[model samples]
Target chain A: METPIEGIQWNSLGFSQTKTDFMVTSRFSTKIGRWEDLQVVQYGPVDVEPASAALNYGFSVFEGVKAFRSEDGSVQLFRPDMNAARFKQSAERMNMAAMDNELFIDAMCKVIAANSRFVPPCGEGALYLRPLLFASNCQLAAETEEFTFVVFASPTGNYFTSVDRGLRVLVTETYNRSAIDGVGFVKASGNYPATMLPKKLAIEKGFDDVLYTDSNESRFVEEASASNLFFVRDGKLYTPDTSRKTIHEGITRASLIYLARNELGMEVVDSEPLTVDMLKSAEEVFLSGTAIVIARVKSLTFENDADQEYKYPSYEVGKQLKEMLMDIQNGKRKAPSSWLIVDVPSLPVQDQ
Target chain B: MVQEGLYLESPREDLDWSSLRFSYTKCPSLVISDIDISDGADGAQWSAPRAIPHDPLKLEPSAGALNYGQTIFEGIKAFRHDDGSIHMFRIDENAKRLQRSAERILIPQVPEEIFVRAVKMCCVWNSSYVPPYDSGGALYLRPLVVATEPYLGVRSSKVFRLVVYATPVGPFFSKPEGLAVRLVTGFHRSYPNGVGSTKMGGNYAPCMQSMAEARQSGYDLVLYLDAKGRGLVEESTAANFFALVDGVLRTPSTHRKTILDGITCDSICYIARHVLGMKVVDDEDLPVELVRTAEQAFFTGTAVIVSPVKRIGHEADSEMAVICKSLDLAQELKVILTDIQFGRREAPEGWLTQVTPSDLEPLT
Candidate 1:
């Protein structure tokens, strides 16, 4: 077995980034018409034109995936193919060139393998991979002829570091996360910045995050700032309809739904529109995302009804689900073999 | 007199200015300013503005501008008068608009003084690129601000950089026949409480696919409606829409904060109301149906200036209506605006800031 890096305090890792050794990158241009071969380079600053479309017009898309160090010290990726497919969709929505799924998966595997030392030990943390595609050429107009794709890694523990009891959420009717026909369904870089202000306001009002309502009617619940939401009523799971095209179809949310129905034998209502009233009456509510694997919602405060608060008494379902999912992720239990990509080849550390 | 050698070499002599299109023709230098807030609250400071050679910018791979769209920009033009002096048109408005955009996305606002000074310095350093007055070209100035911090979280950056560059551009729409616009109802450019009003990078890229698809269908531009299905006119891809209805200039109100506050649209409205003695209805809700019966229609922005719309087609309704054939009003307004910009006509107070060699004396 290869020795892990010496300096990292993996036990105290938070969601913030810890610098790693190497990253993978590729470039595409109109003249080339295809992505160049992936190159492993030192993880550091990159040079881009000041007038590039990525900086000037927000022509960028990104994906998030995590590679885990299992119980036996073997590194494996969880559902990277899903992330690659979504990355292509996001790039297409942003009008930038998208690398094929095969190249996308290959680049992710190479970066994870190169930074294998940074992957935390089992039960501590995971090496988070961020794959970004952006327009790299300088243009005054809202278009670009050249593009760049980079896959970088950071070791992180958990999204919510201190939320052991559960999260307190605020249901906001004033702000909308995305429009009906907007880029909410895609992982465009622009969609996230707009939520920063709303999230800050929610935090100021003493809440963990804001639960956004639809922009058109403001009567239905959409999603939290960064993750997908699920409501458990009468032991049946209800979530927002991603087919509405205004909600991001989170990969973690999909896996949890699959686990709830197939593994736990629970009744799952995946496609129904969970309204504010339904959320208020839910017995248990939770959020799912790549960063926040699964977080229980203890209470929700609605801004519309004189600051009415709804409290949930149980976190049993969420706890069980998190355990089962993590068990699958850590290679503790038997499941579909295709869910985990094991046997990632590690490259020797190069001198910086 | 100021130093004459402070400027770069004169504009390229081999190129035909008349044949230039609305594209980037690199200038000699650009001005930059940076702000850092990483130390503490009181430790926030903006670096002294500096002019550097035109080159690519170095940034951390995880910059907020690249990962989360913390970027905003403004566009202004410098026109050369008959006497060979260059003057920028209404730069103060662009500066204020940029500040508003910055505040929306939580970026540290570039001080109005710094923005104006940097743009003037950038233009003065590249004054030779200000095309000849008779060539119908202008030095287009782009002022951009981006968040440069390397944090992985979705929050405002502790570091921000502002870069101002210049490029010579001809008319945005070279077609003398006028632009053919398609009324797009399928995709909404912006929503009721969204960031459409800001000149942020986020608002533009998402609309490009819609604009490109429109172009492929034999149209020059796409005119978007309100996202709420109110049948109200919003704006074009990157410009504000206007119609000459019943001898009054009508445009969508910006009160909803769903459309950009266009500088050229304001200038045109001022001309229509005060200079040309025409009633301007800028605060009213312009319905999409109004274009079908309007006398003339046009789009206004820093790029387009005032390009007349020849026809508007609605695919859902199966209607193709010609707004105007002669474009008399659009032509007249464009001429008046251009004359004021080039120092031929009397400009309103604070309408133009003439670029002189003295503006670059401090740098020298």
Candidate 2:
């Protein structure tokens, strides 16, 4: 077994980049019709053509996954297959070359194993894996002929710096995350930049993040800036329907829904439109994502009417679910064989 | 003026300039500048622009541009005058538009003077690439800005890099005389509160699929309707739309906040009113039905100067309207625009900025 790296303040880690040791990279071109030259190189800068579609036309997509160091000092990843499948969908939507799921998972494992020392000790934090794919040719037009795929790792702690008393979120009608028929459902790079301004404004007003609404009517709540929203009414759980194509199908959100139905025996409703009124009356509210495991919402304010606010009196549901989820992640509780990848495949001898 | 130690290279002699197509041909040099928001009081600490060799950029794998799409760009053209001098038309407008795009995406705006200087320096350093006055080709300048800070969070980067490069490109459309356009429904380019009007990289990639489908169906371009489903004409994949109806020139208003404020479109409206003495109708919603019955229609942009529309097809309705009975208006506008661009006719004040080549002596 590999030893944890020295000189890392794992306990003080935050949701920022802490460079690791190695990264995996590959290239694809229309001429070759397949990904090639896969290599595990030192983590650093990569050369990119100035006129490449990745730079000129914003042709990029990415995925996020985390690897945890369990109680026995063994490292395991959570739902890497889900991230691989979603990465493929995002790549296809942006007109980029999609990497095969097997190759994607293998690369993730190889990168994490190469940097096993960076994984925090049990209960400290996790090593976050980022898989990025983009068009990488020097072209002036919209179509791309060459592509690049990269997977890099960063050790990070909780996404929210302060979450003891829950978070104050603002409902925004001034800006929309994405259009109805746009790339909201996909984890395209283009979908995130537009939210920066809205998020910054919310923070200035003493809120943690902005909860976006649908671009068509601004009536139904879509999701937060970076994560998916979940509401608890009485004893039932409700979330916005991903079938509307305006909300991202988050892997964490799906896992929680599964746990809520199978483990907790709670009635989960996910196919309904989650409006502001429905959310205001919810007994509890929380967000879910790879970066933010689960965060409780204490209050919500509407942008149009600052006088209007909704406060949640209880966060018991979110706290209970976070513990259950973390237990499975840290290998303390039993999980489906497919959910936790305990035996990470070693790097190929030739590649190593 | 060319900086010391930054000598200009001779124009490339390998290709037939007359047969060049709308594509990227590498030049010798490009101008670049960088800004680090932390270094300044208001996040406006921009380094002095410098000319560098045309080479690939070194970026971290997790750069904001690569991860969150914090990228914006502008497209302008430079013409070779009859007197063997290169000049850029309405470059200031491009500089201003780029600033507006930067504001929408939260990137710190590059001051107009810096933007103009970088573009001019890039053009002058690559003056040889400008096509001959009669070759009907020009040097296309692409000014791009991207957030280079390597971060995982979804916020504007405190660091950005602005680059201005030149590429020799022929006319944008193969058929410069006229083009066949298709009106696409059910696919919206920009929503009311989205970043549609901004010339950011994110706005272009989403429309590639629609453009490719239109090409497969034998159409030169696709026209989009408003995202709100209001049935009002928006714009084409790359350019703005205009039509001539009952002796009046009409186009969509920029106030809708869903379409780009095209500089070429602005110029055409001015020419139509002052030069041609025709009634120009801007600031109104242009419905598709009105354009179908119009006498003529065309597209205007920096790349496509003025491409007359011959036919517009809507497959869902099986409607194919022949637009141009006489191409006199479009042809006239194109000639006037080209004349001013190529220095054949007198230009209005501040319309043209000549890239002085005295300091860019060819290498011995």
Candidate 3:
């Protein structure tokens, strides 16, 4: 018998498509009024109404979490429970139907075990997991209807380009990502489109992405187009307060704060309104997300009442934070007990 | 099972035209206008369009259109002339509006030429389904652009699919009567910062609950107040509202406001001012006081056309109301619009696009 694992380049893979064999799926049957049991099916398209609320009304919410190969031969998940909780919370805010935490965990386990072959070797890359929930029932009227939940996996390395190149961002107060009172805090799909035009304008000016300010005044920081934001200055951390405004309170951002305070014994300052001047004074500015865990910001150019520019010469804090978070994710260092969910069965591929 | 090209109309089909309702019926052919987008690019570049057989789209379960709510659409109507020729009403306006919607939400814009051609293709292929000349029904066309890329990131999709399908349906209001509406204050349908003017998918989904609630309370639909001002009347669930007081036509302003820039509302204003030489006033002020003096009120949309308002009621209690006894002007406007639509009267320049005949006659 010939070994089937040839001609695959795992480490060189960028953030792109590599369809896994199966996808775990579930549906919120408006009939039963709850998420159904997870089922592993071949990855393909599903039939839907042309007027499905997910399409016509933007009633879609989702979460992104990653899985990695541990030093031992066992598969692992890094706090998938957090992603599930966020998805449930987002679905609720969007008036979408969602599943319970237990069902979410069970589905993840089944999906990881089913696609264990695609999990890259240690230090190569991680399997990107995407959990999505959307309205499927089609009607012109505005009523909450049956929703569908699906999870698909892809093997990828970097979300952005080379990690060493870092990022150059433009801060535009001309447009706000989300209204201060809108659905920005939730992982609502509708919230992202508002950023595309701003990012496009910034790209024309030779910038990588755009950072939005508060909608009302454009004074305080909100978030980047793709991910939540974090700044380290004078040994203190700062991010937009999600409780008051529409900032995506990401799990990766949460983990870094956890490490800054408990692991490294640093005072983390956040939830207070953060100003651009404070960010300009910061030693290092970077992003935190499940995709590009941490990427330093080389420069920030902004125009609110007037034009301003800020540059940083160091990635010290961003590097340290990335190492600490990756250590916890990749099994190189011990994680806080609540941060890892590792009982997923690692079924051995006997065919090889 | 639907046969090839027979999905539109059948010669042996049993039909009742008078009782036809506004509904979804499968068209035999679907026209597509699309573009190809790649990573690290600023925007998409649309390519040549095509038409395919009508069927449920094969979408990747995690397509951005499904999970990210990346959808924008346009509604158009095609009327059959007395001589059996089809004339589509104001398709170019819908095309321009669709592009605006695409830009606001970052979906690929359908070029006006491609949009019109695609719409024409769908209308021609489904020509058999264009309700009879005097059925008082127009074949409703729905054109939608959706993100088709299979991805997990909460960003604009790299690929998009533009599809247009036709549904033969009767007029929104079959009789020469008026509708009952209520003023809703509880939930603001949209904000000044929100994407309300464009025909985006998110704009429609949130209003369903409000509309359903209004329907159960013995009202046709609910009118929303602007989120920014909270005093200005914006729009009803699916249409734009206009108040006719004395001799002037007044309604909410959509310029910087969050309300939709309704094409029907635009056409109505155009006809009133240019064709009929009537005074027209467009403002965002609350119509509360004017409701008492308004001789007649009506809704203007592609679906509703010019549906007169029988009365206006409070959101909390439908019993509290202001009633309009006559709909003379409303009926007059409807006749003029429908007359031009069905080709009983000549339309202004470029208002109609004739659907040239072809040999593919499925109905025969």
Candidate 4:
């Protein structure tokens, strides 16, 4: 029998941990030299060495994917293959072992089947899946060969509460998230704590969060604290070209850019870093992520010598793009060639 | 009185104790006052600590420490004296440093009393594993503070865990000729206004690539410079660097906000001023060229005590020094510190703390 999905207020849910019934875990030991202990276990703590490199050294990487209940009753995943591809690239940078796409996709499908009842209704929210890979050897030095890989799911709502009201952002000139030519491009865990100092300062100043600049010059706006940025100007959608620096290549941002240029027949520019003035004078400013989906920006508080305020006209373009993406995600419109995967069957009963 | 939860486990008697490396051993470590970092909950800083078996800790996949690198740690050692008594060197300093590291990452700070007591308990329980003073092995104690709150956001964790463990390891340098180091001009350890000073996990993890490069080319470790200039000598991958220019001893000042404040580095500077009667200057621009022109150079830390510099190599430039066994001041300082540590010589007022049986008792 399926898990009874009762007493759940899916519409009123916030971005929090709900402790679903199951989590998929796997491990790799240096002595054995192969992946072992792969199964769907209870959603609880597993054995970890207190001195593991993940605890003493910043030696871990993770990815985020979302599963949505489509217009049909079947549940589907949005760009899970992209997440797996990026996970492999990130692990290579951190000197960790890689899990091929087949295992990564198979694990996601199993979790969706096992927790098929927990998948929310078509319009409420999606199941957020987090996959974390780390160095699990207990040592002080950085030469760790053993590692652990795990995947867990949580029911989450809008990342920013104000979907309609938009948000205020602080442009931090003093602090940086990561140095270019460093691990900035990779979604390493250490990169998050490095931004808490600047984010705290932004919150204290009554702003939503911070916008980090390049580490050396501190002039060009690289990215937001947690998400990627996009701006619309002169009938063109533009984002920073992260070909060289340490900006995260967001999948949502990539999909929207593809739709705009290929289908909508609009010009999409992946050009230079979006300056503070470009964002101010743009038609619309927005943030994109697996969690933030697509949210419009209201104003920017440039915290340089003098705190100057820059405002955009409206969020018409942002609203349209969000609807376009959600239409395909909810299966209201026919998705492009290979965007959505909707073949997960409901799981059967098990002997607990 | 014996504590209720203290596990007085026997020591291991496996072969090849002489060939032990500085890594995790099978000895049981002590864990204390684990605080859970929860959402909207003001977690306690610490709880009653106890001795536990050395095994894997059960953790969720979304733990803040495992996901965001919200972890910090300290390293110290327990030395066995000539009379077979064991003590720790400046463990109080390690406790204070752990607090600074916790603040940097927003993890709960382990109380100094709890932190110091945990280290002592690990040493007391594993006393048999301490290498003999003549064999030159020391029982290395590792104190780790990690965040364990299960959340998916990129924020600081509210839950935390503290662990202290002991392992017996051979000395860093067993011969007279000291370590050979290469200057890594490509990679950078830390930048300005970064968490370089704090003993956080992020500071050490990024340097693994450079350390691997050094090992591939037959060098001990890599030497780093200011990431901007790639010229000014910062420090080695693990230890701090010092050069003897003129008659004064010089190390990179923490005011530069780049060098980590090694306790061993600080203690040796004290002996230089008060015991050796030499003028020490920590406030000097440490240029990479100083290694070539300076009279002598060395590295210092808790693991590698006063290691003399035998050679410094960059891409094409390599500087070698004469093996002056008699004129090396670093050796003299190491001997004085070791003598005091081994109970063969009287140390300064608050240098070492003897780990007694009563110190292992759990607090009521």
Candidate 5:
């Protein structure tokens, strides 16, 4: 396929949508229940209700995990079990049905098997996997009687950090990613729609992202609209715990918790109620997610409370943690036995 | 299938049109004084159900129901009496439920008398479609209220449409056995601070993914927990839950929100407390796990009056169990409720709304 935009560094850009290979699908009926006819159908437009629960009320949940191209010309998904577990959690959060872990794993395997070639060779672009579930009943009333789940794959280079642009995030009082009791922790579709306006305004203000504060008091840092936030100060790692009201606990964020502690011999504290002052005092800062595994934050712009600004010491992705995470993910460094799933069958694919 | 005692009259729009179909049926007769259009059109003509085409509705893309989710609906069934009389089971309750749904969803109030009249008129007009009482099939009534306004805004629609469609349904659960439900992890169907208790269109859309996943996972249904991820049990996809713990009947209580205070659920609570002499509990404070340990668990709705849960799966907390007692309790309630609905047993005062064919027959 032709490049989406000319004159751009192709390798630096994450696997563009033009390169997305295949998707796995299934149907549900009262008679047959859940039936899977796994195929690598080309990705295309889906009919969405304008007042769909997801569109109007944020009633969808999603998970992002990746398939890796191993050194032996075989494709393997990294801790798909974790993704399935998290997917179930997300599904439940959105009041959707939960996918049995075994079925979820099987579906992911089917996608990887169908698009084996797209699982980029080792050290290249990782295959991004997105599992989406949403309401599908035709009942015009608020009560839904049906639903749909799909797993789509995209071959991408990397996320956010590849741009090498410093992030100028504005902390705004006007917008909050999620209010208390909202579907913030889950990857609900409505959550993203709510963030679009504030995010657009922040981008127009020359910021890469916006850091959302608590919807109630606008006090502590919650998360970026898309990714979870992480900070390091005085050689100690600090990240928001999942217990707080709203935030998507990204898989990469959890992985880093282990990487920072065991692998790097650093004391990693995953849950700390952070504020703008916390960012100002931070020695290092970064964000984590499946798309952008880890991206460093250079500065924080507080639009609320007097528009104050704070900059971190380092603008580059932390070499120690990044290398450590990448090493384990790419099979360069040995992962704790519990973290690796080496025995799983790898689908036949291109050279790794 | 013919009911000899049901009655019908000319549609009157002066009263609140209960749903989309009812609103359509009364459009032509919508006393022009009742016309409340402000958007400045020709103030379009209204037509009866027979005169209107049965194709997909002609509505603006950005209409209220499509944008702000300004819609409410009720599910009811018309039963054929043994004496060839047609009756609606707990229609007044259905009206009250619709009213509550409207109030919660911020839609205009629908009067009880108009709602009953519209349903009776439709039943009379389609009397031939009512299945035989012994056939175990009844006509399912779906009364929907949607916003018809063309403007794109977050507020309620100025132009509202109410409609009712009838379908013959045999049984919601054809399976001889009970359903298996998995207790969801950290997901509440509705939240205490959110729109969980309302039967709004937006509420159901979000749950489609979860229901699809559950059915995919070899489960029949899902029982979502509250927002805190604790074991605070909410309702299933479309039904309310009740438990027979020890000898006391228990159900989740609704405050501002949490679970839809289902009409059937309320009826069951009434029967159990007043008639069966059973202790009833509606404390929304009880954790869901406590109910799971109850002697029996059952679900209630308009279609499947009461059904039982056989299994509960807690994927996150590594908990999964099957409660045989719940199945037994569900069967017990099903028999009682079915007997009352089918007219084999006596119902509480002001419950069943009897209809005569002559009452619904069009006057020459």
Candidate 6:
């Protein structure tokens, strides 16, 4: 029977260790090693050795995928296969064990089926799925042979903690997110921690997120710490593609390209050498991710700017594109059947 | 003329030790001795470790080495031979790797001769911990170098410290059969144009969090690939990888990023290719599938000389099991290597260097 989640208020949510219905998990042991113990389970704290490699060395990778509860009460995953692919890519990059795609897909289905109730109803919110992998050995010389993989889910309303009119991005020249030959491309923990110093600086300067430049030149636009950026000039969409140095391969950004070209008939260029001047010329600027399908950019502050400032024309939430993306995601419009999957089990029933 | 640097004091000789355990615990006895020097010799006895216990050296939180990861270390075991003679294995190689690491991290260089002397002095001072030959243990020596200069920028450290510490340890692996391996697909351990080739503490620090994640998910270790996501292979967090594919021994080359040039890895390559008459290729030109499908996949390092890789995981390919008789070959190699280090067997090309009590005739 399908689990019912009636009268559950999800607004004003925070990340806490609360009891949950299910999670996706996998294990690698010395005996069998690598690809083993792939499964989904009820949510809880996993027993980890203090000497595990991840804690001391930051040897872990993760991906954020969302399951949407469509209007017809069906749970749908958007480009989950791509997430699986990237998950494997990240694991390989970190030197951790790679998860089998079949097992990963099965685990995802099981966890989403078990927690379908937590997936906010269509048009409400998204069931945020975090698929994580890490090294777990106690040996500390330099290399470890132990590892683990897990996928957890949370029902979230918005990715950005605070939803204001729009957002202001401080262009950081002193700080870098990742080096060209570094772990920047992988969604590894180390990549995120490196941004802490810069992110903190941006927050103190009263900005929503930081627009990081290239580590070497500090001239070209890289990413906005978390999500891929999209700029619309004369109604044409443009985004930065993955280079040897940067890591923002946004699934939502990819989806927008399809939406703009196939549905709206707009020229959607995927890769470009996005510069501050190009960003300034853009009439519409937005961020895309699994959590925030699309968000408008209010202003940009460059260190080299006159009075140390440059602003975008759009300070308000992007109206048309947001509706189009969300409408398709919520099953309000007829999606090109390829976007939807079916025959999934019902979610666990929960109390309000 | 004296070289200018930090001042150090020796350990107080009057401390009582009858009741205290000698085992190295999590908390060390407050760095009882330290010293600063700017010069040393070249060959056998590089330099002595000056003892200093007071006014421990201080460093800026954002020191170039801390933020940019400018550090290097060498692990050499002091084996107490059956004849009661103390000896070291391939000290020259360790010193060279240390210099290479320092260069990569953009730190000051330590002459090879000076490095050997400091390690020798530290081992002699802590000689009580050197286990008996029959006791299945040896004195583990770690010579660390880190930037200590006061600076907030990301450039190389203008000043650094060379530290040596010794502790007795049993086998690196608790089990005799050696460890199992897990192949990864997601994380690249190191990359080209990155610091993967060096032995920087920064490189190790970034891997800790992921290592934790790997353990929780149920794997023993991780194997990172190259950035191209192609057939390019690299070393693990601490060790280098080697495999026997169709009777040929192969491992990733150091031409790309994402690998540490391990001493053991080099030894195995020499023995397998030249001594054992096996085909060997150091570069990543070989197919990754061939490496994974090999009868045996093993990692080499100073502590764990050879660990067998049991299984490999990938999103695309099916899981493959390793089928090498690793124990038999590994045991033989381990015996040969350990014997040479302990002076039980004839030195292979002058690999062992004896460090007698007479070497410390004039103790600092």
iRMSD, per candidate, in listed order = 1.2, 1.2, 2.7, 1.7, 9.1, 11.1
CAPRI verdict on model 4?
A: medium
Q: Of 4 and 6, which scores higher on TM-score?
A: 4
| DockQ (Cα-based) for each candidate | 0.73, 0.71, 0.37, 0.57, 0.05, 0.04
The TM-score-based order of candidates, best leading, equals 1, 2, 4, 3, 6, 5
Of 3 and 5, the candidate ranking higher by lDDT: 3
Q: Candidate 5's interface RMSD, please?
A: 9.1
Best by TM-score: 1
Stretches of model 5 off by over 4 angstroms after superposition: A1-352, B1-53, B315-322, B356-364
- lDDT per residue (tens digit) for residues B1-364 in model 6: 1223322222223432322222331212111122232342122222344533222234332233333344466777777788776777778899898887655544556777677767776666666556666664666777777555533212344556676666566555544555555555555555444456666554665554545666666556666666556755566667777777777778877865457777777777766665557788886555566766677677778777666655545324455445455555556656766666677777668467676544544434
Across residues B270-363, which tens digit of lDDT does each residue of candidate 1 receive? 9988988999999989987787788889999989999998888865566656557568888999999998998999999999998775665553
Pairwise lDDT winner, candidates 3 and 4: 4
Q: Which stretches of candidate 4 lie over 4 Å from their true place?
A: A1-4, A158-161, A233-235, A243-245, A264-271, A274-283, A338-342, A345-352, B1-16, B36-43, B173-176, B246-248, B292-295, B316-330, B360-364
Comparing 4 and 5 by DockQ, which wins? 4
Q: Each prediction's Cα RMSD?
A: 2.2, 2.8, 4.9, 3.4, 12.2, 14.1
Deviation in Å, model 3, residue B26 alpha carbon? 2.1
lDDT tens digits, residue span A1-352, model 2: 4767888888678777888878999999989999996688889999988888888888888999998888888888888889999999888777789888788888888888888888888777888999999889888863698999999999987543456478999998888877767678888888877788888888988999889988878889999999999999979999899876678999999999988888888999999887877887888999988887898899988877689779897988788888888888877888865574655654542333
Q: Rank the candidates by lDDT, best first.
A: 2, 1, 4, 3, 5, 6
Q: Where does the lowest 10-residue lDDT sum fall in candidate 6 chain B?
A: B25-34
What lDDT does the true structure give each of the candidates? 0.84, 0.84, 0.75, 0.76, 0.63, 0.62
Cα deviation of A279, candidate 1, in Å: 1.4
Q: Determine which window of 10 residues in candidate 2 chain A has minimal summed lDDT.
A: A343-352
Candidate 3 clashing pairs, residues 3+ apart or interchain: A56-B201, A57-B201, A57-B202, A142-B208, A142-B209
Q: Highest DockQ among the candidates is held by which one?
A: 1
* DockQ, cand. 1: 0.73
Task: Tell me chain A's TM-score in each of the predictions.
Answer: 0.95, 0.96, 0.93, 0.94, 0.87, 0.89
The estimated TM-scores of all candidates read 0.96, 0.95, 0.85, 0.91, 0.53, 0.54
Question: True contacts preserved, each candidate?
Answer: 0.67, 0.68, 0.46, 0.60, 0.04, 0.03
